[model samples]
Target: MRRVRQLAERTPADRERYVDLLRAVAITAVVLGHWTVAVVGYDAAGRPTGRSALPDLPWAYPLTWVAQVMPVFFVVGGFANAASLAARRARGGDAADWLLDRSARLVRPTTVLVLVLAAGALVARLAGVDPSTTRTVVWFATVPLWFLAAYLLVVPLTPLTYALHRRYGLAVPVVMAALVGLGDLARSTDHAGLALGNYLFGWLAVHQLGYVWYDARRKVGARFPPARGVGWTLLLGGLTVLVLLTTVGPYPVSMLNVPGEPLDNAAPPSLALLVLTITQLGLIMVLREPAERWLRRPGPWQAVIAVNAVVLTVFLWHLSAAILLVGGLDAVGLLPTPPVGSPAWLAWRVPWLLMLAVVLAALVAIFGPVEARAGRHRLPVKDAAPDGADRPSDARHQRHPLRAGLAVAGFVAVGAALVMNAVTPREAAEPLGLPVPALLAYLAGAGVLRVLRERPDTRGPTPPASPR
Candidate 1:
């Protein structure tokens, strides 16, 4: 707590408080949204069955548009990654160095959770738990990795994408969004599943928009970052497009994946999702100044810093915490089995949220240091030699471009594998009973990235000279 407060106090006045605030809010909403929408019950055979209540609750569809904050995350990511890359590049850093620094924070928290999950799966299966039950529970627990996977894939490509943004300016996003639309069009035809490319294209487009945001801030005054009324335009325009697409087109209105739904707006990220994201980004931009002002208060700012300090850990472990709470409660008959959307079920949401929060809090306390270490890794050096200590030269620090490419390929494989496994779980057990191939991919890819971290100083990131 003291360290959190001290770190908050040291926050630069020029910092973009709104960015961190948005990130904190977005992830929190996702955790809460997941807890609220899931409806779990037991079948006639006494196996626990879990399903999303989205398709059943028609009124809940619109709520997803608001609740699905993945768009916001990508945008913020664009904003941050752009800043980080520029800073590193100015220091003569290469893509590999930038990727190493960015991904190191992700590595620690992710590894701890993945190992624990693999062990948990092994234990469950060895205890004679039904294969389906163990699979469902473990699958749900690791579902949070999807965001990490996607974000990891994007982080390494910032050099390439940001360059595209610089050369083509706004044309980049226009083309990217167009590709998403084409993918969606192809998805609607006999080749219903042909839009796989949009998964990368759609997210990269949203992320590119973040670069647009950052660039906008750089040109205009950061104090009033977004152009006036841009938010209004996006909100109205995106809302209209979303309505038209869902009603007149093949895309479903719900932003979340619905069980048994033929076409989800968010599965591969359709054109409609990009439109909705414009609305979200506009809303975020419009509120930037006000949010920044609110964040200036020490009380509020400290809370934001504290959350950001361990945000990755909180996000990665949230589902596992919920899974533990739900499964444990169910095993003891403490978990209620009310029909989803019933009055009783609605009433139970408060307690369910409270319990999930409690368990997640415990998880964060235990594993959050892994994430906290990442932030401190970027802090300026407090101690140095009298004559100013030297560090690795730019050339030595830069991984050979080809080697960097291979490293990136590894991370991309991890991310793509995660999305595949999460959407389509494998029923078979592994050598140690690790059920998901994505988990193995994630661990293996991370290992490759780490070994490639062969920088002169392997503690991780090179500390910024000014702590900027």
Candidate 2:
């Protein structure tokens, strides 16, 4: 608490506290939503199993419009990426340097998670756990990796995307929306594989809006937040389209994938999800003023900092925490098996979520420090040199195209491996109960990035600064 308070006190006055708040809220919603709706218990065969409860709860589908916070994450990522890139450029760093800086933070903590998962898998295998049980546990545990994979896929392209945002403004997302519609068409026509392209287009489009938010902040200054009218427009326009799509149009109402549904809106996103993004964006904007004001207080702001400090760690391991608890309880036969969505089940959620929160808190304590340390090294946008007087020489921070390409390849490999695990968890989590190929890919990616970090600049020596 003291550390959090001190850090909060040290934050730059100009920093957008609300962005951090938004990130914290989005991730929190994801964690709680997953925990609340989870159906984890032993099957009739006495094997541990789990699935989402949404399939059985048709009444809960509309709630997903509020619960699906992934788009908000992308939007926040976009804002942060744009700000960080601007700060990097202010320091005379090239896109490659910026990429290295950004990717390193994500990769380091994730490496810890990958190794831990693999080690646990090995233990489970050696302990003679049932193959199917191990596979099921591992699958549930690694479910969150999909978000990391998707985010990593977009991180490298920020420089180009940000450039496009500057050149084209709202047209960029408009075109992306059109492409998403086409992807939906392909999906409706049975080209599910081709429709996967929406993953990139849909997420990138939402991310582009973050750039718009940043521009609005810059244009209006910090005293006033972005216009509320814009928020209303997005809220109304998006909500109306979303209603139409789910009700009259072809898309399902649930923002998440419901098993046995012919069409899933989330896995390979859809035009409907894009529209949901618009609605969510407006909602956040509308709330931004009050949110920002509330965040101004030391108590609320400190809490936000605490959460943001370990946000990535919390996200990476929350599901694992839940799975661990479920396994332990199931082994002892203490696990409850209320019917899905029944009043008894709903009553059980209170304790279920409470216990999961306790376990997740422990996990965060163990792993969150690594991410916090990595974050400390990130370039601070608020503190960036406004006059560019402190900018480093290009010769000192040389851009290495080859090294950048290799780093990107490494990230791609890691992301692809993760996506494979997310898509086919049973197949990917094999042998020692871990996704060996994915683990190796992650290690290789981390190693390549490390080498990139250690490699010396070759663009010639930087001259010493003259005494001013």
Candidate 3:
């Protein structure tokens, strides 16, 4: 037991290969999920409907298991934030500055993307295209922007959440779990308050698990090696929960299958999702070493890094690019209006999805450098010591497991608020154009990031510059 405890004390370094691999995988799943659902259709009045034509593919339902990969993203986010916060604190940096830097990184790239898309929509409208069509296209294309809005809101609150983690430890996960369970029950019973809470509490609960993992790693250290046994247990447990909920319980497994009313799992998230996160995290842990070795190869690792750098951009613009491809194809009379659930429709969708990716890549390639430059903020850097040995204060901040966990909770709260405001009766009924909610969300997120970035630095004693 003493040996095990000692091993646990030796925490691994910050750069965990498995986490990066998981992030890449998660992003790919998101892109493919969007592609699977990216069909172009016309409504009853022969106008374009925002539904995908390939909904009936045999593989579509099963894909949900892999397609609902957002939980992995949150898990990684928790880990990153936690490690970052811890590192910064050790370097005598304030929580505020750490929050500000992260918030800026997330918001800047996203804001540029939004402005460009909004401009394109405006230009299309002015060029005599059907205004309604243009509006719908823009709205559907920008759906992924919601993730950015949620992330920005959460990044600033990492310090508070991390504090909670430090105090409560595993109890944090237990409480979050109970909240999720209660929220699910409320949603099942049609209670508005409970339903709303479930939406915020349920997913946040899973995100908090990321903190749990980080803390456990810190505590268990080398003894808690990423092993196959842990991975299998988590995977089996998650699958069991998913089956129980979807089949025995009242919840639906198909997150995207909301038809009449919005699906419970589709919105705020459900208990089942929390299980999914566990399974994913476990699998990632088990594969950490091997995955890292594979990724070390220049060809694969470089691609992963490249994708990581522009992940937010790709997520935000992929849908828009899909809409553009469909519109262009339809305008040129090369493809017929897509029919929902038709095999022929599915065949065409493959190429359209590819076309969308190509066009999006082109746009990113052209404007990416400029967009990056515009978003860059100049931070003041200090010098190193004379012996070429850097002072402890000069070390780059490591992520705190606690801060990352808190950031997840913060994101969940902010995302829920934004979603509720946008979808509530009052907002829904307002005559504000379709794009208004999205525009407001983006602006609000940007505003929050700007505020966080401007907080006073409380870290004492700046280090001197090293001799050039």
lDDT of candidates 1 onward, in order: 0.75, 0.79, 0.58
Give the Cα RMSD of candidate 2. Answer: 3.7
Lowest-scoring 10 consecutive residues by lDDT in candidate 1?
381-390
* Alpha-carbon runs more than 4 Å astray in model 3: 1-14, 52-59, 124-134, 216-225, 370-448, 451-468
The ten-residue window of minimal lDDT in model 3 covers 379-388
**Residue-by-residue lDDT tens digits, candidate 2, 275-393:** 89889988987898888789889999989888887898999898999888987898888999889988999999999999999999999999989888767623222732333332445
How does candidate 3 score on lDDT?
A: 0.58
What are the runs in model 1 whose C-alpha is more than 4 Å off? 220-225, 377-399, 426-439, 454-468
lDDT of 3 by residue, 254-297 (tens): 65544553344646667777776676766666777687688656
TM-score of 2: 0.92
Error of 1 at 224 (Å): 6.2
| lDDT (C-alpha) at residue 190 in model 2 | 89
lDDT of 1 by residue, 317-363 (tens): 88788778877997888878898889999999999899889999999
Order of all candidates by lDDT, from best down to worst?
2, 1, 3
| Root-mean-square deviation per candidate | 4.4, 3.7, 8.4
Output the better candidate (2/3) by lDDT: 2
Question: How many clashes show up per model?
Answer: 0, 0, 23
